[model samples]
Target: MPELPDVEGFRQVLLTCRGRRSVTDVDVRDAGVLRGVSEERLRKELEGRRLGKAWRHGKWLFVPTGDGPTLVFHFGMTGSLRCCDQEEPIEAHDRIVLTLGGERLLCYRDQRKLQGVRLADSADVDRILEGLGPDALAVDRDEFLELLSGRRGAVKSALMDQSVVAGLGNLLCDEILWRARVAPRTSTRSLSEKTLRRIHAAMGRVLATSVRDGCVPPRRSWLTGRRDDSEPVCPRCGTSMRSTRIAGRRTVWCPHCQN
Candidate 1:
């Protein structure tokens, strides 16, 4: 699934394609990827509006068009945003296309159609985002500590819960736990302040690098890089890594390093 870093990259794509340009047309190739709004309404609302500065919260991307409705995107497992030349071939998965000033195409491509587009007013946007916690990229260490301190459940589960801290997916939670040398199954309430601080620091470092790279990079030295090996080994301790399901997601951790 596309995580926070991936969604951030999509925001950049939107910004690049929408710079000072008005939407010349709206084409909904697959209405299955749209939610709450009809194709006619989407076209009617956004066809000629100028796109404002796009922003992201957690995994959601919001594109405001001046005083009009906001265009919201949630890139599910196989969704992405792309900017292509007007003459370029549209991929089979390009569900929605926005012609910008008739000069370029902004495409919303999704293979799975699990999540897709929505049109929201200010109040609707608020209600849509009301269930989410503080964005992972913006939460401070003290706030992170407090959020986890009040939670009960495995530490990994807490991290993956959007209501507890948004933007962390299975991969990010595993990477953060591995870097912090904390076991995935450790109880949130059992974590000492020092351990929680370490986890927060690891999250910061991991998110910083991931955001810059636009994904959780699979660098050889990182656990993410080695998780898929035929016989995966801990990059730090060289012990064979362990894999199990935690919070209903496959988790990879180093028994020797994280014990």
Candidate 2:
């Protein structure tokens, strides 16, 4: 699934769509990629509108049209936004393509259309944002601690819950916990203030690095680097890494460090 870092990368892709370029065409190769708007309505609303500022919240990317509506994208599991040449051959997975100034092509490509694109006006955007928790990267330390204070569930689950803190996925949850030396099964309510501080700091560091790299980079020194090993070992202590289901997702943790 596309996480915060990945969506941030997509926001960068949307940057090219901004400025003076007008959308000359809106081609819907798969309407399944369209959430609420019909193909005709999408084309009608966007065919000649200029793209303005772009914003991202959690895993959602929003590109505002000068006309008022914003094009919101959620890159489900395998979805991606690719800026390519209009003359180039379209990939089989290209669900929607917007021709910009008849020069560039902003394509929404997805093999599994689990989550795709939606069109929203300013009021609708506010409503959608009202339901989401703060973006993990933008939340301040004090706010982060406050958010975690009420959760009694496993910390890992709380981390992955979009309503609790948006943008963290399975890999990010595991990586942050590993870096904080906190077990995935640790209850949120049991965490000391110091531990929560460590977790928040680790999350910020990890997100900064991952957002810069545009993915949860699997560097060898990080737990994510070895989580897929046949028999994974801790990067810090060389102890065998432990794995089990937590929050119904496979979790990897350093037993020695996190205990």
Candidate 3:
């Protein structure tokens, strides 16, 4: 799945699509990747309109148009955006193509049509985004502590809950828990203030490193780096890592370290 860092990289791709670029054409190869708007509406709304700055919140990417509407993208499990020359051969997965300024083409590609593109006016965009919690990267330590305070779910579940803090996926939750030395099944209410602070710190560090690497990098030194090994060992303690399902997601933790 494309998480925060991957979506951030998509946002960078959008930077090349914006600023004085007029949409010359829109080819909808697969309408399954579009939500709430039909192919005709998409073409009518986009063609000839100039693209402005691009914005990203959590896993969602938004591109403002010269007209009022913004092109929004939610990269479900396997979705991405790319900018290519008009003559470049299109991939089979490239569902939507927006020819920009008669030179560059912006493509919306997805393997699983789980989440798709949406066109929303500013007010509609704000209303739609109101349901999402604060972006994980934007939330500070104090805010993170407050969000986790008094939560009843397991720490890993709480971290993966989009309503609690947007942008975290399975890998991020597990990595954060491992770094903080907290069991995935540990309850947030059971966590002490010191533990919460540790979690907050680990969250910051993990997000920074992942965002920099443009993925939850499975470096050899990190837990993710070793979790899939034949006999996964704790990267820090040299102990065998433990695995279980928390909130229906596979979670790996170090029993000795997290205990």
Top model number, TM-score: 1
TM-score for all predictions? 0.97, 0.96, 0.94
Residue 3 shift from truth in candidate 3, angstroms: 1.0
RMSD of each: 1.0, 1.3, 1.5
Candidate 2: TM-score?
A: 0.96
Candidate 2 structure quality by residue, lDDT tens digits, 1-259: 5889998998888885544588999999999989999999999999889887789999988888896589899999899998888679999999999999989999999999999899999898998788789999889999999999988889999999888888999999999999999999999999999999999999999999999999899999999999999999999999999999998989999899997
Give the per-residue lDDT of model 3 (tens digit) for 184-258: 899899999899889888988999999898888999889989878988999999999998898998888899999
lDDT over C-alpha atoms for residue 236 of model 2: 95
User: Candidate 2 local accuracy as lDDT?
Assistant: 0.91
Ranked candidates, highest lDDT first: 1, 2, 3
- Per-model C-alpha lDDT, please? 0.92, 0.91, 0.88
Question: Model 1, 1-259: lDDT tens per residue?
Answer: 6899999999999888748599999999999998999999999999889988999999999999998999999998899999989999998999999999989899999999999999999998998789899999999989998898877789999999898788999889999999999999999999999999999999999999999999999999999999889999999989999999998999999999896
Better of 1 and 3 by lDDT: 1
- By summed lDDT, the worst window of 10 consecutive residues in model 2 runs over 11-20
List candidate 1 segments past 4 Å from native.
Answer: none
